[model samples]
Target chain A: MIVAFLCQNCAQGAANTAGVQRMRYSDEIHIVRVPCAGRAGAREILHAFNNGAEAVAVIGCCFGACHFSDANLITLRRVKIVKKFLVEMGYSTDCVTMYTSRAAEGDTIVGDFEDILERKYDPETPPCPGGAK
Target chain B: MVRLSVVQLRGCERCAWDLLTLAKNSSVEFVSHPLIDGGSGSDNDADFVVITGYARKSDEARLRELLSRGKKLILYGTCPYTGGIFGLMNQKGADVVPVTEYLSPVASVLGCAPSPDELLSVIEGQSAQRQPLCSECERHFTDEEFDKIIRVPDWSNREKCFNNLGLACSGVLSARCAQRCIDFDTPCRGCVGMVDDPPGRMIGYFGSLAVNLQVDTVATDCATDRLGDRPDEITRSLVDVVGTFFRFHLASHFKFPGRNPSTGDELADIMVARPIEEAPQIAATIYGRYGISVALNLIEAYEAAAGIQVSDETRELRSELRAAQDGLLTALDQHDIEALEGVIDKIRTIGGNEVLSNVYFGGFKRPVKSAKNGFDTYCVGPLEIKAVHARSEDGCSRVSFSTDEQGVIREWSCELRSA
Candidate 1:
């Protein structure tokens, strides 16, 4: 399953519009609401994986558009660091990412949800050990 | 009197040597200690027990039994506190079990080797609260230096904080020590256990930097540094995060194997065996593996098991620091004094001034001494050499000799007899 944490100001608004327009994203992806995408942080995101989530999405406001003053930038940097760790460990770096959305961009958030759900972890690669504890 | 018994399960006996000063303490009665000649038997019956070394899977049953004995258990040295250098092997799924998984220590002493004073203070019921070493650090640095992270700057003694100078100091993650390394102008390698939530803190710290670091930055920062890719090159130094941040806590910090380029190789050994160039750093942090040491590259391991194949100067001397291991191993193991000095000469020719004794002798523990006149006594178990000095009645002639236990000197000590 995929766990997506959506920021209330932007990404959540996009997700709500996607729902209003009846846009279909993967049923496996569950969205959690947060004040800012940075609040999802590495620990909370890793916690989702420990509980059987295959991938995690931290959908925040566009870089300069954060309601909480550069909160999305913090999330972006953390996701990059996490990806570096993942690739170094032989796991798929594509398993997690930070995406930015605008209130009117319903299709973009739904597309991100679908793209993340498609990046299945390969058993042939350094296995994830079923996500970090 | 506090009846104390000490057992060294699996560590460098440096910490045991650290306790030698306590031998003369009147209030503490040492029931058993390896260095204290009369010590023998398990340390089970003492009123207080001090155990050093990281416990192995085989040692778990014995450790639990000691814990069941109901005596106060004090963890002495960083090995028992956070698995020491061996803790790095846990990334390979090695069975380095932390005693905390089974029992909590009554009191804990921290340091790669705790000083005699710190150990004494803890033993006397002055348990220090756990705090990050940063709170006590007085050095200062600006955030701009992270752009060019240097290792051991010439000005490290400038009376500022190590991290403030972009020295890659892990003092922030570590618990406090005597600051011995810092005193000598060396960076704190973080041999002590980490403060709470070290990994989370590391993630935050590294994230905040947004450092666009690459291998060349090390050389760019300091061009005249050692040329060869010696194992102790930039990779082994504090320039990298694993050696800096997770130096002692990788076992508890990460939940994965250390394979990079994903060889998927599995051996009964705790560390994966690889050729010199592809050697693994402690974790997936790099391509290869080092054995039971923080810096023992696969070079010596391959040389010892197979014929000495480091004949290629290009490959062998890449990390010039390792230029002496196999030679020293052969000379010391066979008691060849000339060959040993020969290796020392080679290191000196490479401009290594002073006796460079950094080579890790694989399974052999290096001899260490702190006690006065302990030269021969302390080395007994590791490299048994006895030294004798003699002088003539006229004080005109003198001779000194050293050999393994079986050697005896008689005529060498005889006076010239007016001949």
Candidate 2:
């Protein structure tokens, strides 16, 4: 399965650290680093889903530990609202998920992605053109 | 035929960008002039003057004088309506030299700018129209096959309440624009100025109604910054302050605790004394509470009513609320006082007050007493505050109260009016 991981700040830094250490991770997992998870608006998420990615996850800093103060909380609330919208648009809830991880939780992040990939997902629902998912 | 003249005021390329798009679709003739050129001295011949950006009071006066020569006008973009970002500096006190300095809400002030769509609509003799496309919806208003859509009132009209206008139509920058801004994490400065008919009256009239009705909360969206943080002078700082005030002009002028540009009304005193009124309605509609309740009830009914079907979740929430209400009524009828008390305690835990009180009411109060008359002043007790409001453009709040045997409210110390 094609999996995309949108990582913000701490998560992104951790990915870099993993990369520097030459830590082995699944080649299928693509990591995209962003300034803050909150900056990833609903449009961006929907855009990814519309494109080729079979599943997507937003990795923000752990609640209250965001580098930009309340940025993580804002993103969390926004993701909830966007999830509702996505559900109404007929996308499976399983396809989109939010993951909070500290910089040290690199192994956990990769492990969670592996577990999520094993779940059954419907391929029949056509993706929206230019939407994230 | 609406004769039109387009002037580039003080905005980014958005207004001009949209105007070019408009020029392609309509019969509008382009009256080209240098950006910030004001006018080419041939303004009197134009029928409709379309200003493309925010303008300072000086620019505003020039524009208004030019437009006033028997011609209609449209201000394009947030610059015209709320003066956009450029108006933010108005709060800092920068432009014109003044005798007595003050800040003012410019919603009603002449030469205010508006968005291109707004200007275009005005030029066409139709009221300013908001953006037709909802980003959430792929189709624009013109593309929608449906007819007879429910249209909301304009934001600038005084008749509509801020709450009743819902999340989209009322307040600043058009409801849709406001909601979009919020979605994008931006605050609306109210560039639209309550777009309904019969432009809204600022604090003076609304405040009078509030005092007369003894309403507690005005569902206040407007405020004045007398807090030392406010810039000392406004007239001189017109250039920077113009656009920001334009955005919040409606809230600023109509705000109960604000200053009027002309008469100098103090809105805070009205805010302070509101708690003193018996049965003061904290939340009121159109200066009273009925408007909000009616609007909310209507929305609920619309959602349930056959014509307007609400989401399953909303319907479920409504039914749940009804069931809860029924249960409470039955318990009350059965004399389940303990159960009722428990429920009340639960509500209190959630921060619901038994009866709202203006516990923290009073702010600073300034009287009209002159300095020549020594500051000594005395009055009776339990004074019945007759009316509290500000005069047009003067920006001072007027509190008229009847004295009990001795004047009570006036008993407080007075200071000399500075020249």
Candidate 3:
């Protein structure tokens, strides 16, 4: 399963908009609404992978939209650490990613999920638990 | 006679020689020295087994055999204890490991090369009181005086403290080891791994410092306020503080390492063999917790020491930062800014009230007072805290709180402007 950590304000709201608009995406993604993108950090990211998350996405508010002053930047930095660790320790870098978006853009979130899921069907890589539905 | 055996792992054999040359007692019997008498690895008869150098994948069998012997294992230097210089191979995938994970030792006599007398003291059981290396030759300075500190200093003045000179002396951050470097006028490189996480402490401390320092001194437009800004700097500075921090620029300002050389396919395929749980721990042991993958760039380093993940248990302040992080990620991640901010405020209240109580006004009952005119001061450990507020006829009111420890107004304190 893909564990999607969505910031409740922007990213989660974007996901909510997709839900409200009935925008369809892959069923593999399990949206976890966190207060902000930075809430899901190293431990949480690793924990998701350990619990069988084929991939994890941390989506935060767009730049300057974060009320706490650039917390998305903080999330971006942490995502770097976890991603570096995944690669250096011989884990797939494809398993993790980060993004910033607005609440009105439901289609963008759906598009991101589609792009992520299409990789499962990509000829370059082997198929895993997060299969192409 | 105490049977002493030496196991040379991966470092230069100076620590072993220091033990032998410094031993004046006739009561200790030398049973095996791999370089000298050359006994095999599985000797259980020795009362004291000294292991020097960091462990490598090739040395696993011998290390496990020696550890399995149930003898008193003494980690003889920085390499064995903190993975030493040879551990730099970790990012390269050579698989260097610290002896700390192998077994607890009778004593960890750590240093790049400890003075000859240290081994003698450990054998004699003449244990000295444990304290920070800074306390041995510390020179105190107030908050403002500290900012004037520079990287390099006049070599002539050996009496002065390196930290006071603004030299990033590892002594201040390290535990009381053999004061070998301190006495020799070369500041203490972190030969002994600190009891607390070194990289986190260094970045956090320097982050706070970078905040108070003039922006132009460190950088132009970029501001990296978080702790782990330079992954390469953290790894390089592990045991050699002087090379990375002091005598050079702040370690944060040091260049990040060139990208690690691992192919994405090679990474994905390897996980089939190594479990996910071991990945974090092994990486942590390698540098995740040790050197840490700090700031990706100079801008990120100053942007948010808050940007990096800090899990240091020793400091109460970091705990608050950790608490605030959840609310921040929530606050910053989404569009409902006001509600998420409320979550952050509530967390600060819980954290602040845990430490602060009874808001003792301290004899200031005026119409209102600015922070500078009527401030109350108190001490927490080595830090001195100052706070100010205005009170009504009933008592002190109007308290503002946030998790910014650096802000003139934070936690229990407020930037009480004139009312």
Candidate 4:
């Protein structure tokens, strides 16, 4: 299943907006709210993948717009680190993605989810094991 | 009361002063016999040992004797942690000793001469954590003020960041030196020591920051001197970005030319003689730790230095193919036959016949049929392809090719579409 980490202030608001707008997105996506995307460490993202997330996405505030002042930059760095780790571990680098969204862009969140679903459903790729302890 | 003894193996005794100051201010008793009489500290019966500077062959015996005493070891300077500036003697065949060669220290305070406060903190049984220079100066300026200064600052504005003034501050990668030099309206020279992550993470952070601030060219130009003579224009450009990134910590982190496996002089000669070949390897070893971005940047830098050039035609073709791929993705998402056909025509013009065949075979799960006239295309899901132009030398030829919805090519003919 696709797992998404949404920043509470920005990304989570967009996720809520998408739900309110009744935007159609894949049911395979599971959203996890975080205090800020910066709070999501590399280890935590890797842990989600290790625990059976077929794909992972981190949604945070746009550049230069982080509520915590440069915290999103930390999140961006963490995402890059996790993506590198995933590649080294023989996983598809496309398995993880980071996106920036404003609270008003519900359509963008749904579109990003759709993109994740498309990547996850590649027929050539085998399913990743889920429920990793 | 903890009994502490300070040992100066070789080189300058700068950090010894900090240790002494720490002893005078704290409860730790200093064993002063070694300093007064040139005697070894083994006779002092100290509870803790603080060793500074690079140990030479002659100092090794004394170091071994000190290690044998089994006192808790704390290497208190950059010399012990990374062999320091004197460690450069390793290039000239001098035997320099790093503390790692003998015993593992309980804690290491890594600085040219660590701050007095850091030494005191370690002596007080506290962890001496390194802070980036930015964190130290945050109290003096707010986030908005800092961002404004970094993003857009007056060139003559001396009280703000020195980096904006075209100075090689290295404040981002260095430990907080209390902004002493900056307070005097002078730039920091990074004498304090590198941040905990050193060149890798520090490079990425600062490189991105420089890019954001649009001062990358100036920042890079300032860092080029550290790269030595072998650096080409590409290497010069990146030296500021990556060379500056790992300047202080290069010796400590990666195995370089003048290091143990190879002598510094020998490595220096090789780099000077065969820079294009050897420089990439050195750059790779240094930037590889940071991640793919730095590695890719190094590759581009090396390619540029080596005079490897990609033709504009090829570059244009690559971008066209990329755009076509994006178009194909959009077409698939929207199930638009017209959009798909437009992308197919663009791909055909760009000689993307192989890519089209692969996309059809892999993406659409179709058995593509190729012929002299045209490609018999197949469709899955919603849209259906009637025909696609294959490679042709003479020009457009009318050819009929068809495929069923099940991705089975019914009739095939390979032909080019006329302009």
Candidate 5:
């Protein structure tokens, strides 16, 4: 049940709002904030798995928006690249995913938590159980 | 005053300036002795002999003769320390076919021309031996002088392996100190000897370059000046650290970074900040519809038309384009570029009458105007056709075409031709 958070600028701020509101989230979800979806890379995603993360999600600004200008597009590209590496490394490729949100998307944040936690996760990855190989 | 002597044999004189700066307030002397004449008449009584430049057997013999007189010598510059530019001759199979094989090691080079400071340091009994600064665990002994808590080693090695560490001499003990080599913008040549074998903390000391500027030019410049192939080793070491990033950075500045264009600039440009607004998606859509080559072409076209070289502020954007290009190409290659035939046909059908040529090809030519003049040119020969690659949004298929005439290379639904 390893969990990780990929926070978009808005989503992250919303998470802070959630914290202020005392909204509940699992303690297992380790948050790693990125400037934009575009900054994520395959090496980083794999490094997460190598370092004992079982599930990872990328949160980005709303579909049409980004922080550094065109970062959403960069994020999509990185997601695709990371997905390709995930498939190649023979991990449950779906273990890594991406979502978009706005700073005010508190409801969307709750929905994302439900979706990620309920999704079927494979634990048979080579680096799973323990990172020892 | 500190007495100094300068000699030039086979080396760039930059070390001479460095040595002079170090000895500016001290008394100094200079000499010029080609590897011939047994290098006689040099002052034997001086506090130190600052040996600069290249040295051969003749210089080695003369230096040995000088040392026989019980005088101190300093092998100045990288030339004496690691054979400098002359190390190129040591490349394997580099010997002339007609001559006997000859390859000189760094030890041999230094044995020939000792630096002035090194000579003085050794002669003044300052270099008697490296005090055991570490215990058997290869850790330095350190404790708070203020508190003075007794923290002594519990174990000791009955056998001394410092000899087994393969260190050249105590003089190289300084190599263990975070190589100041980068201080001079030069990568450590390991002339201080191999780091891994020597179990010590002072050695393998990771230190940042004094100057924040990248040291890409150091590899090439030092190699060219040292007249040796040692620079190749330095470059190899750099690659291990930064991968293709170093080559691209240097090449971006020098106009010739490396052998592969796709891997070089294509991967290097992605380190920039990508704005999360509508830009990335719009960029993706534009990129998805037009393909990576088209995007790069547009970026290149925009830069060329603007007649301004990419500024540092916009470099990250360029890097993003490159990173995208690399990702798309790698994805396409894995899936086979031509598999996108159906998508290409569908895109073509969808855009029947629209301008499919989202990509534009500006004629490539030598520079007619510099960036200062607001006129820049992409070097394109009259006969060379620009290659175009197109791929679908899902990255499943891609196809490439090129016309003998001028045009931009990228993915698109429509065809373009020179006016």
Candidate 6:
């Protein structure tokens, strides 16, 4: 299952807009609202993985468009650090990703969710033993 | 009246003289050689002990004796604080000791030789905060002027910011140098020392300037040229990133990966094969030293450049690298010189020896040649190594090496020299 932490102002708004538009995204994907994407710490992301999150995504405001000054940049770095740590722990690094979106880009959010699912379960490489899933 | 005693360990007595001159001009009582009133005072009597220079073994007894006096110790110069120019001795396996190893100083006045005014201020119990050099600089460039910057400018006589002229000016990374070098149309070499900032913020500040000026190519070229020749983009990037960012503060900064232990060869091995368990400690150290903002900026830059995302096999390879380094460190600790070869071979298999040599051996065009006699030789920059010799001195081993060019030979050793 894919777990996404979305910023309330931009990413969550986009998800809400997608819902109103009746866009089709993977039902396996679940969304959690966060005050800002920067609020998602590495420990929380690791916790999601520990609790059976197959893939993790953090969506925030587009670069330079963050409502809070450079909060999205913080989100980017935190995600990267978690991804690196996950890789070191013998897990797939690509299972964790960061995305940026505008409130109006509902279609992009749906597409990104689908893409993460496909990439996480690529048939060429077998699932890592004792992987997050 | 507070008594101050200045002791010269091994560096030039310029700072001591400066302090004496300032004391003479002030109401403060300073005691040193050639006393104005023809009177000498014992160091034990002084309220504060200002020590200058890299502490050698001969100075150990004296230092111990002085420390026994129970007076407040102030490491008064760069040498005592950070080993100063003598820090280069670390590359040669010298045992130059900073005052911090003995005991924590009340204050550290860091400069090649701190100005008498700064010394006086420290003596007066004033805290010195490093301010950004840009705040003191008068030069300002418009967008158009910044856009015109190239790696090598045609006009050297132009009066403008050296950075705008494509020079590798470290003003952005440094504390104020009063624009002394920049005014003379020379690039700032960060001689005064780095401001207390993470290297990442400095990189971001420079990178943003490059992007805004549309001179990323120029900036990259300047960095590449400064780092000498290396073929791989990642290697070149690593060198460029470190060279540009950690120019002055390499010895002091925690994030650079080679500051602690001062073992270049082993550090190269450890950096290339960073252990999974050590990542948190490394991250914490970087964050603790440079703060959150700077740490984040650096992480972004490093991830973007290095493509840290790895596959399962690569992860295993990194683990092997970690084991190899741990073995090497263990061997060094146990004095098992014979086991180092095997450990180095394992590291080479995991992370190519060529990459290791290029990164730590100063980017030599050829592989490092082990001497038939005993010394290991490698080219460092433009200089060709003729020979290296290791000798024992006062319970410590000192490595001495010579570089030759056009029949002229110059020698350098880890041995501390007299002022």
lDDT, residue B163, model 3: 52
How high is each candidate's interface RMSD, in Å? 12.4, 22.7, 11.4, 14.9, 20.9, 13.9
For candidate 2, the chain B TM-score comes to 0.33
- C-alpha displacement of B343 in model 4, angstroms? 77
Q: Report lDDT (Cα) of residue B389, candidate 1.
A: 31
- How would you encode candidate 5's per-residue C-alpha lDDT over B1-419 as one tens digit per residue? 44434455543343443333233324443332322223454565455555565454445555555456554455554445444323322211111110001222222112211233454455444652322222212322222111111111111221322222211112223243222221211122232332222212111121111111111211111111001112222222221111111111111111111112221221111211111111111132223323343434433433343343544323333344344445434433343333333333332222110112221223211122212232233222122223323221222222222211123222223222211
Per-residue lDDT of model 6, residues B1-419, tens digit only: 66777776764343443355455454566664322322255665677877876664456677787778888888876667655444333323335555566667788776544555666677677986667665666655444323332332233235456566544466666565322334323344453555543333443343333432211111111111011111222221222233333333333332111222333442121122232111212221212111112212222222323333323333334345445545654554453535655764564443334112121112122222321221123222222212222222221212232223211113322332111
Q: What does the lDDT read for residue B272 in candidate 1?
A: 30
Of the candidates shown, which would achieve the greatest TM-score relative to the real structure?
A: 1
- Residue-wise C-alpha lDDT for candidate 2, range B1-419, written one tens digit per residue: 34456666553433443344344444665554332233463555566565555555556466545544655554454455444433333323222211011222211212122234555555555644345223332212221111111122222232333222221222232434312322211123344443432112221111112211211111111110001111112111111111222233422221111121211212121112112221111211111112112222322322222133333333333233233334334444454545544533332221112111111011001111211222122110122322222111101111222222211111111111111
> How far in Å is the alpha carbon of B283 misplaced in model 5?
39
DockQ of 2: 0.01
> What lDDT does candidate 2 reach at residue B39?
45
Q: Residue B10 of candidate 1: its Cα lDDT?
A: 68
Q: Give a tens-digit lDDT track for model 6, residues A22-122.
A: 98888888898998877775545655765677777887776677888876665554454344333323346567777776688687677667666876878
Q: For residue B252, what is the lDDT in candidate 2?
A: 25
Q: Where does model 6 exceed 4 Å of error?
A: A1-133, B1-3, B7-42, B53-69, B78-108, B124-132, B135-138, B141-159, B163-179, B189-195, B212-240, B255-419
Best by lDDT: 1
Candidate 3 C-alpha lDDT tens digits along A1-133: 8888888898788788899999898888888989987677655665576467777887777656885676666566445544444443334445566666678878667766765566545666433322222
Instruction: Give the clash count for each candidate.
Output: 12, 72, 27, 6, 48, 0
Worst 10 residues of 1 chain B by lDDT: B217-226
Model 1: CA > 4 A from native:
A1-5, A20-34, A40-57, A122-124, A131-133, B34-40, B129-132, B135-138, B143-145, B148-167, B184-186, B211-240, B259-419
- Model 4 earns a TM-score of 0.38
Order the candidate numbers by DockQ, best to worst: 1, 3, 6, 4, 5, 2
CAPRI-style docking class of model 4 based on DockQ: incorrect
Q: Which prediction has the highest DockQ against the true structure?
A: 1
DockQ scores for all predicted structures: 0.21, 0.01, 0.07, 0.03, 0.01, 0.04
